[model samples]
Target: MWISWMIIAVMVGIECVEAGLNTLTKVAMTSGMSDFVFVVYSNSLALLFLLPSTLIYHRIFLLGLLSCTAQILLYTGIGFSSPTVASAMTGLIPAFTFVLALITRMEKLDLKVKSSQAKSIGTIVSIVGAYIVIFYQGPPIMFSQSLPILHSPSESPLSNWIIGGFLLATSSFVISVLYIVQTWIIKDYPAEMVVTLIARVFVAILSAIIALIVESDPKAWTLRPDMELVTIVYSAFLMVTIRSVIHAWACRTKGPVFVTTFRPLGMVFAVFMGVTFLKDTLHVGSVIGAIIIALGLYSVMWGKAKEVEIIENSFICRINSSSEEVPLLQNKSIDV
Candidate 1:
């Protein structure tokens, strides 16, 4: 019970961290930090924070490279496409992760099992709810007069929506792969700090290589002691390190399916954060969609809890049976 709740708490924390990351990344881009440059700086700063720690695992570097590749492709996809499409595509992460987990034998696909069915249905509901909130914002249902929220102006969709859609979908799939592979790796390594550091180091190296090839202006490399600096520093230590450690621990303790299921919750968190910081309007669609998301989250949690309970029961039964056999064997030896 405690472990389940801990995983839930971690998921909530992840959502909060992700929401802040999205907001900060947007502001950084607005401040002339290209996606490539921001990735380089953020990952470099993260690596700096991680280098002093004792390293235990090297295999995590490969996972780190995959993660970095996904981020590069994802951000670049957003650049090629519209933010609308990117946001919508992110809802696919959990679905893709679920599929990969099944293929990798990390997750059992038993449609007849109640837990499995619940998990499957919950995933679909969450995905639907996320898209509803993202793609269709209805009129304001409620508005606070104190702090007027300004919905950021929407830009026209890219002409090559098909190409952009493909890029974003591919990026989402890669990210899903990262989630599964990272979790699988953690089962053996089980060193969260080491994994975190390796991930950051590799991401920094990759992002730096990409940044050099693309960003020519030396001024773009310069970081003023402003929001840009704040974004880099805060995102590096708190955002990357803390979030990565928490995720690695969760993936180690739980599974990739559990870790990825929380992605939809990010949409919920982003909505509230937007209302608070961006002072965005509270639309009816937002209200309904959030409720649906909450339902899906609850369903998923219930299914996961049931799965844990079943495992624990089987384990307890095995222990009891083993103890019974031990006493019988002891009696037989005494008789002999």
Candidate 2:
């Protein structure tokens, strides 16, 4: 139907927009914009837009801390590595989320169930793929042939690449933790928009404090009249407002599974935009590792889908049995 098509279009558009902005941010940072300052500014702008939606806030400071930490790590990783690396690392979130859920007792692990076994195996495979990407650069499949100026200074060293990879991985893990916490918070505070606004406020304030401490140069807070300003405005309006609204709508209309199913597409967009616009090289190890991660991600998704299906089926059967028992009890009463 049209609704399904629209959802697909918007989800793909969201991924493309995210990839483009990531590339733009990298270019802006490469042009002397401080990563810390960028995070502070973008989040501050987001706060301005979300101010009108402020409804309530509970004891959710931890949400802000996690989000701020994740943003700092993510942006710093982009500065050290490339958008492609950041996108590739996102595939690890589900794997990390599953593991954390088990640790938190939010999810159970049953070795007898094939679904749980698949999730466990998928987690291991995802971790292995992450290691391979971090430890091995291999040869360039697509060398930088244009936009020579965009080549990241940090990318010249293997150690920086490894560090960037770990930072990105940690960022994804932090986001997974955020997801888990968000679920808990939603039980008490059902207003997602309010929770998001509160979290953004926290991120803005926290990031600003950190920026002031690390980037003491008053000039670092000053925005350039060029791409820096553009990136901030774009992030504030499109990334913060439009993207969030679309994702929330999609999740409510379809389901989280429908939204998450499109996540892998982000890496494709990142690779295309990075290679084409930023003239980033495609490394063999990154490709191989990404493919491996994708495989594991799909495996985990399948297991999750199966588990959900089984749970739904069991609930339906229970309801039907209860209904049948109700009729038999009524008949016995009538006979009496």
The C-alpha lDDT values of all candidates are 0.77, 0.75
Candidate 1's displacement at residue 131, Å, is: 0.6
Q: Give the local distance difference test score of model 2.
A: 0.75
Q: Give the residue spans of candidate 1 off by over 4 A.
A: 55-59, 77-88, 143-153, 160-167
lDDT by residue (1-336, candidate 1, tens digit) is 677787788788877777666665655666666788877888788877787786565756778788788877766765555444465577788899989998999999788999998899999998898889876888987675423222243443446556667887898899888888888788988888888888888888888998899988888888888767877787788767878888888888888888878887777777777677665667888777778878887887788888988999999999999999998999999999
Per lDDT, the best of the predicted structures is 1
Writing each residue's lDDT as its tens digit, candidate 2 over 1-336 gives 577678778887997898788788888888889999988888789877877876566556898899889888988998888777787687677566666667777678899999888867766666566556545779989887758557654445888888888999899889777767766666555666777777777888898899989997888888889989999888877776677656556545543433544555567677677677777777787677768766765676577668878988999999999999999999999999
Give RMSD (Å) of candidate 1 vs. truth. Answer: 2.8
TM-score of each: 0.90, 0.82
Where does model 2 exceed 4 Å of error? 1-16, 57-59, 123-144, 152-155, 241-265, 283-294
